[model samples]
Target: MLASMPGLRPDQEGPSLAEQMTALPVATLVVRPDNSIADANVRAETLLNMARSAIIGSDVARTIRIAEAGARFDIWHSNKAVAAYDIKVHAGRTAEMELDLMIAPIVDHDGWRVVSLHAQSQARKIGHRGSSGGARSAMGAAAILAHEIKNPLSGIRGAAQLLESSHNGQDSALTQLICNEVDRIAALIDRMQDFTTDRTLECQPGNIYPLIDRAAGIAAAGFARNVRITKRYDPSLPSANINDDALVQVMINLLKNAAEALEHVPKPRIRVETAFRHGVSVMVGDGKGSAVLPIEILVIDNGPGVPEHILDHLFNPFITAKRDGQGLGLALVDKLVRDMNGFVQYSRDREAGESCFRILLPMGMA
Candidate 1:
C-alpha cells in the first residue's frame, strides 16, 4: 500500500494512492525513501516537459527543485505536511515557473512523500478564495447597488400593478409585463444581498431526503416541467446537520441551474442522488482538527455543461454561463453550505456526459 489510514483500506474500499494521483488535474510526484522520484503522473510529465519513463527513478532534488531554501528538506526531516504558495519551481531543464506546492508524507511509510504542484496560472484561475480582497470588494459594491435599487424597484412594481387595472388590451398586457419585470429585479436584488449578509443559520439534525424531494418537486412543477427528473437515494443514509431551509434553497438553486442548462437538449435529464461517502472530512471552524462529512448529495445533469471560460469561477459571485444570469445562485449556495459546516464541489464527468454538483454535509452530532 502506498498509504494507509487508521480504519480505511485503500486497496479494497476506495481509490489506491496511485490511482488517485493519476486522477488529479494538477501535477503530482511521489518521492521514495531514498529521495528518488518514485512516480510521476501524466500532468507532471506535461508540466516538467519530460517523459514519465525519464522522470521516474530520477533524483527528486535534481528533477523537481523548490527554490525556497530548505523548504523541501524541512518536510522530509519533519515528516509533516507543507503548503508553500506562489513559490518558484525548476523542473528538469525547463525555465522557472511560479507554482503552489502541497507536500505531505505518506502515512504508514517512512520518508515517502507525495508532492502536488499547481502552476500560477491554473492556481489563479481555479482557486476559490471568496474571502479574498477582490471578492470582498465586489460583494461590497453589489450590496450597495442592491440596497439602492430595491426601493425604486418596489415602487415601480406597485405603480405597474395599479396601472394594470385601469388599462385595456395591449396596454393591460404591457402593465403586467412591467410588474413582472420589476418583481424579477427585486428578487435578483434579494439574492445579491445574500452575498453581503453574514447571517448564521441554526442547524439541526434532520433527514435530508425530505428536503431533496421537496426541492425536486418544486422544480418539476415549474422550470423543470419538461425535464426528466430522477431520484436515487440511499435510504439508510444517516441524518445530516443542516439548516432545513438552507438545504432546500441550495437544492432548488442547483436544480434550477441544471434545468436551464438543459433547455435546448434533445432529452434533458437530471438526477439527484444521495449516499454515505466514507473517509470524507473537512477542517472545522476552530481549525484545530476536521469534522467528518459522510453524507453526500449529488445533483447530476446531462446538458452542454458550464462554459469552460467560467467553470473555474462557477461559484464566484457575478461569474455566470447564462446570458441573463446574475450568477449569485451558486455563490449563495456555497455560503449557506459552509455556514452549516459542509462543502460542495462541481465536476464534469466527460465519459458519462454529465455535470455533477456534489454536496457533503457532516453527520448530526445528536
Candidate 2:
C-alpha cells in the first residue's frame, strides 16, 4: 500500500530522504514510530559531538537525556508537533555553549520527525558608538535643503493656483501639473523631517518580547500575511535597556524588509528569537577598551538571499535593493540602535539560502 502511494517507494531509489535531510545545514533526525532514532544529520552529529553510527538506533528520549540533561523533559514527552527549548552543550576544545533546539514533525514520511538546532552564541560585538556625527550632519544638510526648497515650492503652488484661476481651458492642465509637483516635493520634505527632528530615546529596562510580538503582528496583518512567522524565545532572557518605541520601529523595519524579500517565494518563513549571550565584547573605536554586549535579538528570514553586489554596503545611508524605496529605513534603524548603545549586522547563509540579522545590545547600563 505504501509503495502504491505517489512519491513513496518501498525500496531505495536515489538518496533516502533521511540522507537528504542529513545534508541540510540544520540538524535533523528521523525517528521511527516508536521514537527510536533512525538517522541523524552531519550538523547534528557535530552539534552533539557524537558520531552518527553511535547515535542511530538509540531511543530518542534516551539520547535526549544524555545530550540535553538540562532540557525540559516534559515538553519532549508530550508528543507536540513543535517545541523549542534551550540546552547547554560542552564544546570539547571551545567553551561550553548554549543551544536552542526546535523539534517538528515531518509529514508523508511515516510519522518521522526532523529537529533543527541553532547554537546561541554572543553576536559579533560592535562598538558602542558609530558614525553618528556624520549622520547628524547628513540630517542637517537634508533639513536645510528641505527648508530652502519649501519656500520656492509654496510660491510655485500659489503661482500655479493663481494661473489656474485666470486660465480659460487647456492651460489649466499645466497649472495642475505644477500643483502636483509642489505636493510631491512637500511629501518628500515631511519624510526627511522625521530624521531632521532631534528626538532622544527614553531608555528603560523592559522585556523585548512584547515589542517583537507587536511588530510580528503588524507584519502578519499586512505585507507578511503569506509568510509563516516562528518564534523561538528564551524565557530566561534578561530585560534589555532600550527605548521600547525605538525598538519597535527597528523590528518593524526588519519585518517589512523580510516580508518584501519573500514575496516571490513559496513557503515564505521568518523566525524571531531572543537570548542572552556571554563573552562577546565590542570596542568603541581604535585604541578603545572592549565592553561586553550580552543581550541579543535575532531576525531570520528564509527567502531568496540578498544580492551579492550590495551586501557590503547594506548599512550605508541611501542603500536599498527595492525600487521606489527611500533607503532610509535601515539607516534609521542603525541610528536608533546606536542611540541605545547597540549594534546590528547582517549575515547571509548561502548554503541554507537564508539571510540573518543579528542585533546586539547591552543588557543594562553598567
Candidate 3:
C-alpha cells in the first residue's frame, strides 16, 4: 500500500519489482541517461494511458507535460530529489492534472531519473484533464456556436433547395454544392458534440472478435478497397470489457485511418491481430487496484508510418496529418477506450520500423 510509499529502493524485498510498483498508488517513472523512458510502473501507465511496453522508449518530455515554470526547474537542474506541491502536469493528450511531483536523480546510473507523482488531496484524484482551465469557457462557446450555426445552416439549405428547383443554369449547381456543404457541416457538428458531451459509457463484457471482423469488413468493402485486410486471431481469447458500439466505432476509426494512409502503396496490406497477454495489468480510474488488461488487439499496416512530429500528440484533439482533417478520429478513439477502462497507444516494434496501433483492453475477469 501507499502507506509505505514505495520508492526506487533497490534492496526492498518480499514483493517483486513489478508487484511493488503496481501496488503503490504513486506514479513512478525511470528516465534513462539519454532522457528516454527506461521503465514506468503501473500508476504511471494509468496516468499516461499507455501500456508499460509501449511507453518504454518514448521521449520523456513528450509524454509528460510540465505546465508550470518553477515546479520542475530546480529539481532537474540540481540533480537532486525535490518535492513540489500543487503543480500542474499534463499526461499525454488528456487534460492537465495537478500533482505533487517528486524528481530525483539516480546516482549510480549516470544521471538517470526516478520521478514520482502523487495526488496531494482526496479532492484532487487524477482523471479528466481537459483544456488548460479554458474547457468550461470553450464548452459554453461551442454550445452557442453550434446553436447559431445550425439555424443559419437550415435557412441556407432551404434557400438552396428553392434555387435548385427554379433555376437550370450552372448557378443551380453552385446552389446544390452549398446545400451539400451545409449538411456536411451539420454532420460534423454532431460529431463535435459527441466530444463535448459527458456521456456515460454503455460497457459490458462481450466478444471482441466479431466487432473487429465487422469493422474490418466495412473498411475493406468501402474505403480500404485497394488493400487486403488480414486477421491473426487467438480464438480462445476472453471477452473484453467494453461497450460494443463504442468499441466498434474505435475499430472502424483505426481501420479507416490505416486504409487511408495506405492509399498509394503498391502492396498495401492491413493486419488485424488479437491475442491474450499474461501478466499485463494497469491501474485506471482513481486507483482502487490494478485491472488485469490481458486482451491485446493490434492494427498493423504496411504503409509509411505516422509522422514523427505528430506522434507525441497523436491522441490530442485537433492534431492531424491530413490536409482536410479536423483530427478527431484518434482523439475519440482514446476517449472511448478510456471510458471502457482500456488503453491504446502508438508504437513500433523496432526503431524506425512499421508503425502499429496497439490496444490493450481488460478481459471479462481479473
Candidate 4:
C-alpha cells in the first residue's frame, strides 16, 4: 500500500509516498491522471532497463507495450484493481520481459494507478552464501576431492602416457585427449583445494551445447554406456554467461543421476536439450535488481522418476535415492551453477514419463 495517498492522514507517522515507492522490492510505476508516468522507482528502472529521466513523463502506452496483441489497457477506465500473470512487457526497443503485473487505482485520484511488475523466475534465485548447508557440504567434498582424486588422476595420466606411445593417428589423439582431460580435472581439483567455499568462478560468454555434448560423450563412455542418449538443441539459442567447466560438471552429474535411475528400466533413454525461455529472470545476490535468464538447458530421462520419499529434499546436501550414493553430486551441481549466476530444478514430466533436470542461465553475448 502506498503512503500519503488521498486517503491517508497528512500527519501519518510512517514513510512518505516517495519513500514507500523507493523501498518497494518489486518494480513500480505511478501513472498520472493523463496515463503519463508520474514517477518510477529504482526497481522499475531496472526492470525496464531505462533511466528515471527516460521513463518519467512518458505516455505509459507509448513507453510500455503489453505484448499480448488482444489485451486492452482498461485500468484507467475502471476503479477496480487489475492483476495479470505471465504477461510480457516490451519497453521501447528492448527485449520482451515476462512479468506478473498488478495495477491498482489510487483511492481518490481518478485515472491514477500504481503498477507493480515482478519477473516470472524471481523465485529461482540461487546464489552462493557461506551459511547454506549445501555450501558446507561442497566445501567438505572439495577438500576430499583435492586429496583423494588427485592421486588417481596422476595414475590415469601415467596410463594415458603409456598408451600414447603405442597408438597412432586417431588412437594417439584419443590418448592425448585423455591426458588433456586428466590435466584439466587435476586443475579443477587444485582450485578446490581451498576449503573456504568463498571462491568465485570465472564466467564468460559461451554456448552451452558444446559443453552438453562433452558431458554426454563422457557419460556414454562410462556409466551411461547402455543408455540411449539424444540431443534436442534450439539452434538459435543465444550464448549464456557461464563457467564452462562448471556447466560441464553440472550436466555430467545430472546425466549420471538419470543413468543410475534407469539402471533397471527396460529401455532407458536420456534426452539433453536447450532452448530460449522468454522473460525468465532471477534476482541476483547483490539485491540491486534481477538478471534475465533466457537460456534453458534440460536433461531428461525416461526413468522411474525420483523416489517420492526424498523428492522434496532432492537438491539438499546428502539427500539421495541411491543405496550407496554419497549424495554430493546434485549438491555440488547446485552450488556450481548458482555460483555462475544460474539455477537448477528437478521435475517429473508425468505425461512423458520422464524425470527432468532443468537449468536456467543468464544470456551471454553472441
Candidate 5:
C-alpha cells in the first residue's frame, strides 16, 4: 500500500502523492538498486530530521544501517518480504532502532525496493558485530562473583545459625532473617553457576508428548493453578533428540513464565502445541549442507505480550522484566536447548494477540 497509490499520479492536482505518504505513520522509503533513496514519507523525514529535498536521491545505508541479528543487511540482500515481526537495526552511526520492517517489490519496476519502517519500543541490545565479547565478559564476571561471594556467605550463615539458637525474643527473628537471606543468596549463586559449567549434555531420542503431559500436570497443580492450559499435540510426531529431564525443565520454566505473565489478566490461557513440520533446515558447512530440524513444539499464551525493551534480549542472562528476577531462566533454557543441538526463539503474533515461544528439535540425527 505504501508503494502503490490507486488511481493517483504525480501530475494530479489537490494533495498529490507525496502528501498521502506524509500522512502515513510509518517511515516509508523507496530505494534504488544502488541503495539510494528515490522517495520517503513525511514520517521518514521527521525520523531522519531532514527535508524531502535532502532525503530524496540519497544513500539509505548512510542514513540508516539495518542488521538482522549477526547477519547485517540480510533483508536488503534477500528477495522476499519479512512481515508481522519486529527487527533490530543499527540506525545512524551509533543509534539503534527496533521497528517493523516490510520490504515489497514495486509492481512493474525491477531492482527497486519499497522499505517501510514502523517504529516500536523494544531495542535489541545484542547482535551487533562486536557485542558478543561483552556478553561473555558479563557471564564470566557472574561466575567469578558467585564463587567468591559463597565463601563469605557460608561463614555468615553459620554465624546466624549459632546466634539464632542462643538468642531469644525479637533477636531470634533477626538471626533467622539472616539465615534465610543467606540461603536465598546461596541458591541464587548456585543457579548462576549453571551458566559457567561446562557440563556435557547426554541426549537420547525420546517422545516429548508424555513429557509435556507430565509438566502440564505439575503446573496445573502448582504454579499455573489460576491459568487455563490446553494442549494440541501431534500424536504421530517422532522422537525428539533431547534429554527428557532437561526438556521437562525447559517446559516447567516456560510454564512458570507464562503463568507469571498472566497474573493480572482476567482471562489467562496457555496453549501447548506439538507438530511435525517437514523440510525445515539451515545451511551449514559452506552453505552446501542442510541440517534438518522438523520436530516443532510451541508454547503460546494469551497474555498481553513481552515488554518492548526486553523482547530482543529475552534469552540473555540478567535481562528480565520481573521484579526480584535474576533473569536467568530463559537464558538457561536457551543454553539447554542449544546443548541438545536444538534452537529456541521467542515471537509474538500481534494480530492474533498472543505470545509464542517455539522450540525446534531434530528427530534423530541431522
Candidate 6:
C-alpha cells in the first residue's frame, strides 16, 4: 500500500521529496528506510557531481565518503534518531571542499527513513567591507571637525576661567558653566581622535579565557558591580590571533553596554561565552565569490534588548541607546575590529530576554 502511495515515488501520482527539497537553497538528500539514497535535490546532485538518475536508489554511503574514508551507511542505519558527521568531499577530480552532514530519521507511510546532508564550503566567507568603509569616512570627517574646534575651545576655556576668578555670585556660576561645557566638548573630541587614528594591529596567539576573566573582574569592581557576571569558556578552544590590548578594549565596551542595559532590571546579569563554531562563515563580497569566515566570540546580556527602531543602525556613528551616551564606543569598536579583518553584529533575543552580539574573526591560515 505504501509503495503505491502517490507521494512515495516518481512513478506514483504525487510529487517526490526530491522535487520539494530542490526548491531550498541548501543541498538536501533523502534516504530510504534501508539507508539507500531514495532521492536528492538539484543542489545535492551538483554538490556530488553526479546525475540524479545515477544517485537515486543507490546506497547513500556509495556517493558520500566522510573524512574518515569509511562506509557511513551503518551510522545512519543505527537506531539513533539523529546523527552528524563532517567530511571533505571531492568537488571535482582535483578540487576538495569540507562539508557538514546532518542525518535525521523521519517516519512516513513507507516506514522509518533518514533525511539528511548539506554541503558547506569554507571558501565562501562574508566580511563587512561596505560598512567598514562608511565608518572610516564618518570617523575621518568627525576627527577633522573635532581638530578644527580644539584650538578655539582652549581659548574659550581660558577666558571662562579668568572670568570666573574675577566675577562673583551669578556671574561666577555662568563662567563655571562655560568652562564645564568646554571640558565636556574636549573630552568628546579625544574619544573621536581615538576612533580616527590608524594603527597596525599587534597580533599574537593568546588564550581568550584570561582576557575575558580580566574584563569581568574590572566590570565586577566598577560600573557592573551591582550586576552579576557569568563566564562560560570552552577549554578546548584554541588561541585566537588578536591584539591583547585591542581585544581588551572590545570586551570592556561590550561589558559597559551590557551593564548599562541591565541597570534598572531586577536581578541584572551579564554572560560572556567563547567556543569554536563550525560552518559559520562571512561573505566578504556581494558577488558569487566570497571567502569563508571562521571562529566567533559571543557576548550576551539579560536586559530589555536593543530597541527595534534603531536596531539596524546600531553600528553606525553616533548611535546610542543611553540618554547620556556619546555613542562613539561601539562605532570605534566596529572600526577596530574591521581593521583586523573581523566583523561585529548584534541581535535581540526575545525568548532569552537579552541582546546578543557576535564577533567573527578569521582563524590563522594553515
The C-alpha TM-scores of every prediction are 0.66, 0.58, 0.63, 0.54, 0.64, 0.65
Sorted on lDDT, highest at the top, how do the candidates line up? 1, 4, 5, 3, 2, 6
lDDT of 1 at 29: 92
Q: How many clashing residue pairs, candidate 4?
A: 0
Candidate 2 stretches with Cα past 4 Å from truth are 1-129, 157-184, 197-200, 285-289
Give lDDT per model, in order. Answer: 0.78, 0.71, 0.72, 0.76, 0.73, 0.68
Which residue pairs show collisions in model 4? none
User: What is the lDDT for 250 in model 5?
Assistant: 88
Model 4 Cα lDDT, one tens digit per residue, 28-74: 99998788899999988987888999999998877777665654343
**Which residue runs does candidate 6 get wrong by more than 4 Å?**
1-16, 19-131, 168-170, 283-294, 364-366
Candidate 1: minimum summed lDDT over ten consecutive residues — where? 281-290
lDDT of 1 by residue, 217-306 (tens): 999999999999999999899899999999999999999999999999999999999998764544332223445678999999999887
Poorly placed runs, candidate 4 (over 4 Å): 1-132, 137-196
lDDT of 2 by residue, 18-73 (tens): 55675798667777767788888898788767788977887766565424434323
Please estimate how well model 1 matches the true structure, expressed as its whole-model Cα lDDT.
0.78
Residue 23 lDDT in candidate 6: 83
Q: Given candidate 3, what's the lDDT at residue 264?
A: 77
> By summed lDDT, which 10 consecutive residues of candidate 2 come out lowest?
121-130
lDDT of 4: 0.76
lDDT of candidate 6 at residue 44, scale 0 to 100: 72
What are the clashing pairs of model 3?
95-129, 95-130
Best by lDDT, which number? Answer: 1
* Winning candidate number (TM-score): 1
After superposition, the stretches of candidate 5 with alpha carbons farther than 4 Å from their true spots are 1-139, 168-170, 283-288
Q: lDDT tens digits, residues 104-149, model 3?
A: 7877777798878775422122122222222333345557768888
The predicted structure with the larger TM-score, 1 or 2, is: 1
List the candidate 3 regions with Cα displacement exceeding 4 Å. Answer: 1-144, 166-170, 350-352
TM-score of 1: 0.66
